[model samples]
Target: MQLIEQNYARMRETATRDLTAAYLDRAMAELRGELTPRKPEEKALTWYDPDQTVGFWARRMSLEAVAHRVDAELAAGEPVMPIPADLAVDGIDEILVTFLAFASRQWPEDFGDGLAGADGRAVSISVGTDRRLVRPAASGVEVSRDDSTAEASISGAPQDVLLWLWGRGDGAGLTFDGDPELVKRLRYLLKEATQ
Candidate 1:
């Protein structure tokens, strides 16, 4: 995927506003024409997985765009628009289920080092008390979305939780209870997974 490498390199190289905007416009136009018509079940290529579905890429791209928009807003000292609760929830789910759950796929070498100490206890993250996302913080991360027990719980509003999970927002509106060790492990996993 030379284009992927090229795109990443281009992102690191600063360009004029016109050039950047033009490139983005062309990319978006191509995406609309090519990817928009693809079925959700259709096979797609991802940075981490080539055997992914169009639906996976679609959800991932949407969440990535939102995360980048937040980064732009923060970089420019501009106010970020409120993310809808549903989108925020979905973004949280995506990060937890795909990114953290598949941590080995991204950085297998450094991943285990980041997760040195693990007791195999789970952390239950709550999105307004309705969603119970339990993920065990271990060398091999896994998320179980069900009414499960965990050693720790982090509860917050959907958007706040999503932003905090992404390191875009402080955990001011969030509350943590139960085992601190579990929370620490999970937070470290989240940071490593997102990074």
Candidate 2:
């Protein structure tokens, strides 16, 4: 806990209002430098990046920055702005694709038990007009853009869906279709994977 406290303190100290622009510029430069050496077709190993590619990291980081900006604003008691629908869609995709996949790999035992009830069952997720169908795979989950008749479906606006998927929202505004018990089970699995 001491190490965590020290790191938290260090972050607090460095979190200055005046240096925000400079910090962002420097961070972008570093990220660009890291991406510059990669071939167009190459897939890089990334812990939290989506799709194992530089492009995915760039997109994911952009969304992350916007989310963190909301967090900072909320901390300062300012009104929050909505994230763009497209960006929120991408954020949801990153969680479903990159984050969950990495989590399953890191903690296989947790997922094996967590996802068992929902295994081989397809769950369709809809955010506005965007949609994805996902089913359990041996490794984690597999996603496809095409719609299918799923065992359960969750539908909501992009922002609400993104917030719900990230555990920031309670899914109160989302609609659940098909079997209620199956939806509950899938929600549990998603929460466990994210945690």
Candidate 3:
């Protein structure tokens, strides 16, 4: 951790915004090269499937870059721009489908209580017209689009939902309906899984 911090400090000392932009462009170009020659069976550690690898990184990095930009803007005492609806929706999908889904499966014992709630209990997240229901399943976690009733529901714009899920912003403008305890449990589960 100390070495990582030192490296970051050194980079910060030498990096200007223009230099960073140039570096990012070069890095992205190189990353694009990574996909060009690699076969599907080539080993890679990705959160999503091989067929969806490029799409997954594009969505993941878009959200990560925007979130990091927000951090920079905050440090500079500037207001942050909102994320686009499409990107934010993809971000939500990434969290629920990849991050949390894999994490719960990888650490079933830790997530057992949080995911395996009472029978018929589930939490729903709605961003505009997009709705996803998450419930504990025999396999680990089950996520699907469902308009049915749920034990708890959170509704907001896609950007707000993404930010709230990532613990970046307070959920002041969001609406939470139904069981508060369940919502809190869901929040805890998200944080734990992400960490």
Candidate 4:
């Protein structure tokens, strides 16, 4: 579904405002009473149940709001605020362990080559208190936190890093001190998938 695109220049200006309402309206319209069985053994899911519906929409709206707010902050040339540690951790868990895991199984090619191979390695990704280790089953891409001992470190404001991950920022002012190829590949994959 097409989500509303806001052109807010800064999230600091909008943080107190509620963006969830607009997302809820859209989600309700799109998923109303829809019950598409995801697996043969399980029953279909629907929005008719208040609890189920609210839970689903809450996650969706939260991510949507957080992502856009990050964008707004970036556009305004301000440091991106730390997504509350709890929220960030939950989001990372759901996206990597739940959403992307399923997507990878269903559409392996989307994750790239090493993700489908046996020698593939997992990389640990952490943002603030949020952390996860994901390996491409066939792809050889490896992501890990830079060892504090590295002579040089790749660094940027956390917000820029988050925006880069979300495929939103230009990455112009970001720093890269490690494997340039890996960084390039990561950026390429994000861009490719979003496109």
Better by lDDT, candidate 2 or 1: 1
TM-score of 3: 0.73
Per-residue lDDT of 117 in model 3? 61
Q: Tell me how candidate 4 scores on lDDT.
A: 0.48
Off by over 4 Å in 1: 1-16, 47-51, 105-108, 137-139
lDDT by residue (tens digit), candidate 1, 135-175: 55345766776786777888898988899888888788899
> What is candidate 3's lDDT per residue for 98-133, written digit by digit as tens?
767666776767664766663446889998789999
lDDT tens per residue, model 2, 67-105: 566565557666546777767887898888766656665
For candidate 3, the 10 contiguous residues with the lowest summed lDDT are 1-10
Cα RMSD for predicted model 2: 7.4
Instruction: List runs of model 2 lying over 4 Å from the truth.
Output: 1-45, 48-52, 74-77, 101-107, 110-112, 137-139
- Location of the lowest summed lDDT over 10 successive residues in candidate 2: 1-10
- Model 1: pairs clashing at backbone N, Cα or C within 3 Å: none
| Clashes (candidate 2) | 0
Better of 2 and 4 by TM-score: 2
Q: Which lDDT value does model 4 have at 100?
A: 49
* Ranking of predictions according to lDDT: 1, 3, 2, 4
Reference-based lDDT, each prediction: 0.70, 0.67, 0.69, 0.48
RMSD of each: 5.8, 7.4, 6.8, 8.6
